[model samples]
Target: MKSSTLSTLLVAKAIFEKTKSLVNSGDKYSCTAGIILLQDFVELVVLAVLDELDAGDQKSLESKSFDELLGELKKLKVPVVKSGTIKALNKQRVISKHYGQLSEPASIINYFSTAIVFTDALLEHVIGSKLQEIFLTDILKDSPSKDFLKEAIDVAGNGGYLQALALLRKAFFLSYEREYCIYSFRQQESSNGFFGLLGMLGGGRKAYPWTRNKAWIEANVKAPADYIQVDHEKLKTDCMEWGVSTVDVENFRRLTPKVVETEKGVWHLDYDTNFAANELSLENFNYCLDVVLDFLLKKQAFDDGHKWPKRVKSGPTPMIYIDKPIFERPSTTSAIVEYVKEDYYYTVDRVVSGFDVNEEFLYAHLYPKDKEFSLTLEDHIWGYLLAE
Candidate 1:
């Protein structure tokens, strides 16, 4: 491990311990601040790991945002924190700093735990005894193509879809060589000097030594797979069969302009304009990239005899609202309900038979109490307020 990597891990651990201490002290403000610092430290650790791996130059690192850095790490096959966990922590950090709000003790604790888990995993990947075991099994089997795939991922993340596609094409070929046990051969060129003199003396167009070895050797002589012919429709079907959406595949295809074969037999994008000037949507690129990467990772996990985590439930779960209040309502027609969660506030207007004016004792008598609820009704008034 590099010195920078070791120092980053130490700093992250120190901040994580400090955060735990703050949480133990029951100081919400200080705990929230500490968690924010911990998140920054975790990001630094990621950068340091990339530096240790020599994944990219400083100019490239400087151009990428934090999210892109995470993407690069994922491409390099580094086992770090999940993207969702990082996004949630970032959201909490933003709310704390910009809104001047401190998260509840429980949320703060969850954030700290997430940070610690990520830091541990990153350290294991960076400096553990079994460093080679950290990479996915597929990458290990076909190690030569790993660098090409990483480059493709980084290029795709940077919005160079054409160049990334080219890299992917090369990676596919390299991986195919491993899968099909193919070998290369060099063609002999015609000679005009001594070889020509030998040919004239032998009264033949060319002369060759029978003892010379062939250009290529294959232990298992067999026909290789036809890699040149790519069936886009079949690829799309395969992606769908692997649980990827046709919509996302189609979106990716749209961004990939058709390549044309010139008279000289060279393939190139049809457009003549500059690649940087071409309008590309980062959101679309990210969505497609996630879909592709997810499919590949899941396949790799399966090949390695590992169980992939269950797919996260999509959409949103319906919020359950209890019909009864903790205290009896004073009004029989309408009421004003106020809910507070941490520093954020929400109001619910309901037409009911009664309401409670108690500001300190109101609570929703939910059948099942959920501590994770973002908002809880704190007070209710007998009638609707004019300001509302």
Candidate 2:
């Protein structure tokens, strides 16, 4: 268990105790405050479980309201708390906070009592012990890859084969990206001198052995700008060569085409029929899961470095301002624009000319330095700021 986890659990326990004390004080105001505190404690427990599970993005979760948080938890099927229970507690909280209604003393007591039970169950599920035993036992260890695998298996068990395959693909791509980054660093370091660096920059040199073949690069890379491309076929072959079972490799290969397809022209997941019954065997899916997990774990063991390099500030660059407001209502828009000058932020305004708008789709095109960039606004509240 990390120190942060420990501290969160401790705070949750303290809040629980305080809520109980307030309820016992026999005062209406104190009891209402206790109910609110209990709600806070439940939320804290939910967050702690999410962190423990290595679930989804913490920042996204932070932005969600209480109802939204519960909805997400339902999607994840977290066993800690039930949806009905959360809604009931939230209802009480709403009455106490917004309606200026004090819950009956017995109702408040019952709410607190239910909260205690819920928190206790949640702690046990997350840490495998009650609050008191948490410090006595070794801390829980979480693996994002393993968690993803579990989620995939759970989804598959519920007959959502396509969804499960999507999760498996996610796990595969995450590991692949990390492996590609490591290979990139190694290739960059091994190159000879300035020209060697130029070869890399100009995409003249092969980063990996598969890149030695031009046809393979075109088929696998798909895009000229994709430097860290991994060929799924090659990846399957490598896994088998590295001792992954043939059946597992074949099973994975069989599913790859269905997982992604070139529709019209653009490639994307074949979501429609991918989840149809009998498309994939349970045994093969399990085997493929094992194979991917084993391969990634083996690769991870070889390179124990962090997944990404720490970002460093680049040299200063010129700034360009927007001469006219991009949106009709500036307050309602959350869009931003920037230009890239060899890895530094530069600004662009109408003065740069070439501002084309497609009102039907809420998209705009900008031509800065003869390069075209497109921006769109959809459900995004904070539309976009392009720089990078």
Candidate 3:
């Protein structure tokens, strides 16, 4: 290899090493330092590429702000490398930098926690591959690393001070192996708690978290942080503002499934795993649940004076068991939760079979060839976490 080639690789190696060093410190200073370092490096390399293309006389790409430079690149008549992700990263930088007038401490940690992941991808760009292609689907779900997720959930947004109690509750149940690395979004005190930004997957070239709701709206001069403070009410208002409804039976049924009984017994009927896969994020779940609840509630399903009936039709209730264990921090015991939705609208915390409540049903009777563990369902969620 040429000496120049070796020199480039060494530069990349140094940058990569420095990035990890930034992550080693747990505070926000490290995060800010990491982002600044990576941002500067990306700028220099892209500018060098532009200079090599003999565009020097036309315009110095470095002179323009990040946004103008990116827009110019898109308009380039020549064969320029089209990259949405890189542009997205630059856009994120603008938001994080200009809007970060809030705090020194919180900004540092949030950026550091997020920039490390971006740095990894930037290094990949320093070579020539997109990072996502190399990883598995499951890897995408539980991303950035589990340790990161644990530390980040405690992350304060620009407005973290307002609602520290919400995150402190420790009462919420979350899918640890979720499809989002949500720390990329605006880290702030949220009304919906940790799950508020859950399924917001894409920001085009950048991960959705990095690109977030704007800090300000043009029309009314509302405080940017107010969006997080009243997300639930705002969301409801936004939906009503849109003023649209779905009249299709197929779409409605897809949202609200009928309970079916086969030889294997009862489960969510006509279940579309794909639908649940994406909607597992908090936003989507609440949206779907609301649509179903709206339809049923209008007919007085939950009301005591309903003409059709006060309760649901007779059906066999299933049990939820834990033949396997899924881990949670602080408490290593695996948790298995199973709850049944009864006849159209009525649902309960557990399966009620002829005046009896059963909680063991979601697990398999035998472990797979690669696995082995036995746990009772009662011992997991309520037993372990709730146990005094």
lDDT of 3 at 171: 10
Better of 1 and 2 by TM-score: 2
Once model 1 is optimally superposed onto the true structure by TM-score, how far is the C-alpha of residue 58 displaced, in angstroms? 3.5
TM-score of 1: 0.32
Top TM-score hit: 2
lDDT of 1 at 264: 31
TM-score of candidate 2 relative to the true fold: 0.34
Q: Quick one: ranking by lDDT, best first?
A: 2, 1, 3
Worst 10 residues of 2 by lDDT: 377-386
lDDT of 2 by residue, 122-207 (tens): 77776775553453233322455556666877787787766777667656644453333212322343345453454444333434
Off by over 4 Å in 2: 80-82, 135-388
Work out candidate 1's RMSD over C-alphas. Answer: 30.8
TM-score of each: 0.32, 0.34, 0.23
What is the per-residue lDDT of model 3 for residues 1-388, given as tens digits with 9 covering 90 to 100? 2243334433543463465346445556565555555555455444433443444442555478765654554455422242444555555556556775222444444544443344334434443322222121112234233222223224422323212212211111021101211222344333132334332431111223223333322332243221122223433443344332333112333443223211222222233466545433433322333232232222222233436734566544433333323222223334433222121121123221211122222211222223223232222232211111
